[model samples]
Target: MSAQDYAEISTLMQAYADGLYHADSKALRQVFHPRLAYVCATPGDELHLDLETYTARIDKRTPPSETGDARDDRVLEIKLATPQLAHVTASMALMGRTYLDLLTLQRTPEGWRIVTKVFSYVPMEKS
Candidate 1:
C-alpha cells in the first residue's frame, strides 16, 4: 500500500471513532464493509457480530451523563499484509481507560473498508 492508501485508511478509521462518539451512523458505516463482522473480548471471553450488531453499539452522540474527557479516544496501528490487505488494530480509551479493537481490512470497489473488528477491554488503571 502506498503511503496515501495508509493515510486514507487511517482517516476513515478516525472518522469511525469520531462517529461512534457522536452517534453518527452514517459516518460510522462509511469505513465498514457491508458484511463487516466485529468481535469483542470481554473479561470473560470474545464476542462476535456482523455489521448490524456493530451498528447497534455506535451512538449518534455521547449521552449527557458522560462526564469524562469526551469518552472517545481511538488509536490505530496499521500493518500492511499486501497491497490489498492490511491488519489494523485500534486501542481505545473511553473515560480514560485503554481497550483493544482489532480489525482486518481489504481494498474494495469503494475503497479500503474494515471487514472484521475484534474488541477487548482492560483494567481502568494499573497497580
Candidate 2:
C-alpha cells in the first residue's frame, strides 16, 4: 500500500475510536460501510449486529467523554491483504473492560470503510 493508503486507513481507525468514545453516530457511520456486519461472542450466545442496530444502540448510550469515564484505544496492527482489502486489530477499553476487535476493511469508491468487525470482550479482574 502507498503512504496515502496507510494514512487514510489510520485516520479511519482513529475516527472509529473517537466516534465510539463520544457516541457520535455520524462519525461512526462515516467509517463503517452501509452493509457492515458486527459480530461478538458472548458467554451464552453470539451477537450479530447490522449497521442500523448498532447505531441505535449507540444513540441510547451516554458517551464516555461526557460521563468522565476513561477510555483507551490502540491499533494493534493493520495488514493489507490486497490493494482493496485489509484487516486491522485494535484494543479498546470500555466500561472498565478491555475488548479486542478484528476489523475487515474494503477500499470503496468513497474511501476505506470497515465491512466487518469481530470482537471479543475481556472481563477485568476485581480490584
Candidate 3:
C-alpha cells in the first residue's frame, strides 16, 4: 500500500477510537461501513452487533470524556494486505476494562471504511 493508503487508514482508526471515547455516533458512522459486523468473544462474555446496533449502544453510554477518565487509546498496528484491504489492531480503555480490537477495513468508492470489527476486553486491575 502507498503512504496515502496508510495515512487514510490511520485516520480511520483514530476516528474509531475517538468515537468510542466520546460516544459519538456521527463519528462512528463516518468511518464504519453500512454492513459492519461487530463481534466479541471473551469466554463467558460474547457479543455480536451490527453497525446500527453498535452505534446505538455507544450513543447511550456515558462517555469517558465526561467522566474525566484517563484516555488510553492506541493504534497497535496497521497492515495492508492489498491496496484495497487493510487490517488494524487497537488497544483502548473504556468503562473499567481494556479492549483489544482487530478491525478490517476496505477501500471503497467513497473512502476507507471499517467493514468488520472483532474485539476482546479484560477488566483493568485497580491500583
Candidate 4:
C-alpha cells in the first residue's frame, strides 16, 4: 500500500478512537460509514447497532474526559484485503473495561470509513 493509503486509514482509525474517548458525534460520523453495523457479543447473547442508534447512545453518555477517566486506545493491526478494503483490530478502555474491536473498512470517494465493527468486552475486578 502507498504511504498515503496508510496515512488515510490511520487518520480515520484515530478519529474513531478520539470520538469514543470524547463522545464526539461529528467525529464518530466522519469515521464510520452511514450504514455501519456495530456488533457486540456478550455471555448470553449478541447486540447489534446501526449508525444512528450508536451515535445516539454516544450522545447520551458523559464524555470520558469529563468523568476523569484516562483514555487508552491502540490500533493493534490493519490488514489490507485490497486497495479498497481492510480489516482492523483495535483495543480501547471504557468504564473500567477493556474492549477489542474488529473493524472492517472500505475506501470510498470520501475516504476510509469503518463499515462493520465486532467487539468483545473484558471485564475487570473491582479493587
Candidate number of the best lDDT: 2
TM-scores across all candidates? 0.80, 0.95, 0.96, 0.95
Better of 2 and 4 by lDDT: 2
Could you give me the TM-score of model 3 versus the true structure? 0.96
Per-residue lDDT over 1-127 for candidate 2, one digit per residue giving the tens place of the 0 to 100 score = 7898899999999999999999999999999999999999656658999999999999999998998877889999989999999999999997767889999999999999999999988777757
Q: Which stretches of candidate 4 lie over 4 Å from their true place?
A: none
Which residue pairs does candidate 4 place in steric collision?
none
Q: Candidate 3's residue-wise lDDT over 24-121, tens digit each?
A: 99999999999999999777889889988998898899999999988899998899988889999999987889999999998899899999899899
Best prediction by TM-score: 3
Q: Please list the C-alpha lDDT of all candidates, in the order they appear.
A: 0.75, 0.93, 0.90, 0.91
- Which stretches in model 2 have alpha-carbon errors above 4 Å? none
Q: lDDT, candidate 3, residue 12?
A: 84
TM-score of 1: 0.80
The CA lDDT at 68 in model 1 is 45
Tens digit per residue, CA lDDT, model 4, 42-85: 66648999999999999998999789887889999988899999
- Per residue, candidate 1 scores C-alpha lDDT tens digits across 1-127 of 6889889888878887776656666776898999998777786867778887667766434632254454646555788899889988777666445678888889998888988887788757744
